[model samples]
Target: MIKNFKWLLLVSLSFVACNNDDNTTVVEEPVSSGTASFTKYVALGDSFAAGYSDGALFKKGQEGSYVNIVAQQFATAGGGDFKIPFTSDNFGGLLLGGNVIAGVRLYFNGAGPAPVSGTPTTEVSTKITGPFNNLGIPGAKSYHLVAPGYGNVAGVASGKANPYFARFATSSGTTVLADALVQAPTFFSLWIGGNDVLGYATSGGVGVNQTGNLDPATYGGNDITDPNVFASVYSSLVTNLTANGAKGVVANLPYVNTLPYFTTVPYNPVPLTAEVAAQLNAGYAAYNGGLQYAAANGLITAAEATKRTVKFVAGSNAVVVVDSYLTNLAAYGIPSYRQATAEDLPVLTSRTFIGTLVNGNPAAVNGVSVPLADQWILTKDEIAEVKVATDAYNVTIKAIADAKGLAFVDTKVIMTQLSSGGIVSNSFTLTSAYVTGGAFSLDGIHPSPRGYALIANAFTAAINAKYSSTLKPVDLSQYSILYPAIIQ
Candidate 1:
């Protein structure tokens, strides 16, 4: 009887020990910080920084913004809370005073892109109270961030101020930089100057490339900003932001043409049959004959005549064109006509404009016969102009990063890798292949949520290297690739 009682006691003790093991809590691996303070993080930039996706800024985009992602990681590394000026709804609309200032977000509506139904729930007149973390304003240029009256609500209607800035500016006449400075940020991310070059490229180089001009006010909305002007404004911005001994990160501009927006459309998209091609060539025969005549008469050099020659073929071909820059060759009846070359870039919006009938003639398609205007094309010269400005801006940014002992995020190299082959992150690959690439949103220029997460990781790595912070990188799989076609 004593031996049986001892066996029962042993069994009960083993069962109790097993029950205790089942109830034990497993502690998660904690993220550590070497010595970085992210108590207040502020992000400053243009559309890309503002979480603008699907051609608009909305709640979901703001929620998944790279800055927000960084803030979350910062929390793990002894950082504090992060806040953003979130738009009211996922529809991405905005109202000012009482009028609709911006339209709703774009969604793929089975057939094509269209705005979601309903007006914006957020009203700009009812401004949210201040000291928000993310201060990115869409349509802001390098100079605009420092320009006074940039946030004046009264100036919104007159084009004197940016509507996006006006929506969240603390006062009527405060500049974006001023508001950012007021926050006394411990860490900041400055990604301005993209618009300085993007405006010219996206406008098909129609706007003036104000390369030599240092005055920004003289520049138009689509004009390429003067690199010197960008440097001056950017330097002043950094100097003021870092005067209080704050550490931050700065990023150089990416090659804008690499995104799907510019690469998706081919330069020579027009195709024609043998007979149709012959007919099209015949139509330009007069211009071709005139070029030869001009070369014979020596009115223009032989090289000039050849360069301006217009030709066509059966399969795929480019259209002939005339612009303000053709050497006034009306004497030879050349009409400054020349076929678009491979170096030209068509605007993404041209997808709809191409292949339409010209003058109601089916055989004479628009792209086949009616040449696209300068606004629809970026000539090789225009692309070169953009490159020069971008290079100069990058140099300035690098110099600033070095001088201020800040982290330099080489966005150009990152984008190049994304465009060339593919970037691998956490076992997933990302590319710059338009909507299907999983990196870019439907807008083709901005990154999707997952893409933004990848960017956040890059920034975190840069921060960790420069500031000795132990911020854990975000898992790319957690963020979304694309929003649903139609949200509930």
Candidate 2:
């Protein structure tokens, strides 16, 4: 009886094992590329493409450029040699035919920002002949890339040439786009038009918007390029890059105001003692009284006058300002005066002057009784202008991507994410904050090595998805956050 019972148990166990095997699920590995290729890759863009970090384009920065990172990944998938117009040192600046056209990189000396102590070693006259892979110019705009003689060393003196390009142009009169086309790439990536709106934003709207002006020559260094001009230039670029039937990836611009360079300094940065606050308010009494009087006289609305009223408290408070938008009331013995609101963003440079005494008055600081100048603040209206232009440019870019059937990387989305909730990659969180954020460098405008790695991953994903390629994404955690000054 015992033997029979054991036999039954064994039989039941065998039946259960067979059922488990039949119900087992199989998981297939992710699919890679079907027809995509990265035989010869080229990158065309501005400073970000050149790896201009910490406000300088040095050797290490160039090596860590997002394009370079992408190219390195391409190498694993049968990509060819990739080259850059590498500067001699990691200190950035370049000598244009023996003159300093760009400034040195910035570093933290445990105090504030200071220029890296070194003479530039990259000479513009020393040309690196190509078919080069990394064709990024540090300061090139959308139109500048297609403009003839933009890389001519002789044109540098006349402000028609980019110093960064002069260092590596195949010939004196070649445009950046033409030079890039000469490479005959199998895969390409473009990230232009940033400087189109960046200049206006960085200049605190000191430059013209040039909204209706189609001529690129008439635009100032800080002016915003017309969206039509951007469209024409951008279309020309895509048409030429794709002329060879090469697949490519393109990235849209991020709102410049979201960068640490503009957002680092808060609007309400002023902290005053009760006594100092009272004294400062007393000094503004005349201006406040004038505003109220104007409101009563119908010179300005009572609500506007109230909105422009200056007030200070012992704790954190917004600094008063003389905005350019205010109506000139000097004829009425009233100067257009107002206090800065939460919407205002003081330029990063304003931090140096905010606490400084105005005309040697300790009690009256620059941001206090003196009021910050229009150039130091990005007013709410100016921000609106930036937004409009950004939107228009992105529209043009997306349209081009759709028409060309190329991969598109939405940088603005990721940038906003980085600035707000931050992004986690490989269990590491990276923000858009300067220095410590491990995303942006000391300059706050450009990204650090890790940040570039993140961008490279974005490009890789887009390329893999659009072209049906299996190119692996770069591991962000492997890249260094920031390079040391000494580079030991």
Candidate 3:
């Protein structure tokens, strides 16, 4: 009986050891202090800081956000708990589905108006139990960061009442982000302000006209931000972030136009039917001729207007021109500077607008040709506007980071290399489309899982250099950054 008891005891011990081994996942954390000193960290930023992607906040993504991932690395190195938002699988990432995205897609349940994405059920009061980490609001801007209770659940904290961050916020109490900041963080990572520009560009780059005219598109004017205000608010936000004794890392904005959504879109209006094209072409040319003559007479600067062009679509024996420009070119007395109206362009001209073939390959344009994705190259004026604004924002960011003693992650410089196709690393390479490994998400603005990992590495490197800390760089091998799109 003694011998038998010993045998059972030995088996029980072995089982416990096996379970322990499975649970043990040791990872080296990155250094946060100068040359390696910080043992604690708190991350704060906007959407990029949060793991909100694919129009939904899934469990994998929310936990996998760079902030949380880096926190995990820290925990493995004896850092403390790395608390982040979590949601069950099969739940969406953000509230709205990712159809507007340039690459993200969803599994079909074979239903129309398919499920729109949804925010997580775990609100602030619930998920955040202890001293928290990773407080990134999805739609936060430089100025909005301090809006009291702006993004919180209907009640918890004032910082939790944001419309943009609403999808990720909880109704439990105060905002998860604002409360985390009040804890007096030791280390943080901040990357905000992308939405300041992205939101404007994505919304068709038009502003609503108070006139309440025929169509919203026609009435809207250009409400792009004034360059000066952008810098001032950015500085204010950055300065405040540092005032709390938090050693943080700051990132600059990426080129808003570089994303495939912006680059791979059409510029000209749609082509008209063969017979219709001829009739419109006559009126359109006559109208354009008059504008050109009038403009030369000091009536308008030719620089202000797009040169008229008649498009020849593939498989269509027709030439379509815009009478819209000519028709209202002289109606220039409106609030909008004599720029051509949406009415003047083809029916659909938005760079990011998508149309289903309902006939040909899913990627077809206007139900006909395989639309060339790289149609709307940024015009010189647009490039000038982007660069000038970007430079101003970067200057402010660098200054604040230096003052606050945080690392500066130069995302602007990093993204300049996103051209054609190239390998980002040995294990993962870049594909042109949404195939798994493609660096960009469907929206083109955000990065794919692989791409975000790349961002994490860059940030780690920055922290290492600035703080003299010896944080471990992540092994991105296990992660899947590419999309696998099986075109039907």
- lDDT tens digits by residue: candidate 3, 180-225: 5566666667787676555445433333322121122321122344
User: How far out, in Å, is residue 477 in model 2?
Assistant: 2.2
lDDT tens string, model 2, 335-419? Answer: 7668788888788888787879977877667877777877788888888888998999999999999999999999999899889
Over 4 Å off, model 1? 1-29, 110-112, 208-219, 323-326, 330-333
Q: How far is candidate 3 from the true structure (C-alpha RMSD, Å)?
A: 11.4
- Say which prediction, candidate 1 or candidate 2, comes out ahead on lDDT: 2
Weakest 10 consecutive residues of candidate 2 by summed lDDT: 209-218
Candidate with maximal TM-score? 2
Position 361, candidate 1: lDDT: 86
Error of 1 at 368 (Å): 1.7
lDDT: worst 10-residue window of model 3: 211-220
Query: How much lDDT does each candidate structure score?
Result: 0.81, 0.83, 0.52
Task: TM-score each candidate.
Answer: 0.89, 0.90, 0.67
Q: In angstroms, give how far residue 167 of model 1 lies from its true place.
A: 0.7
RMSD of each: 5.1, 4.9, 11.4
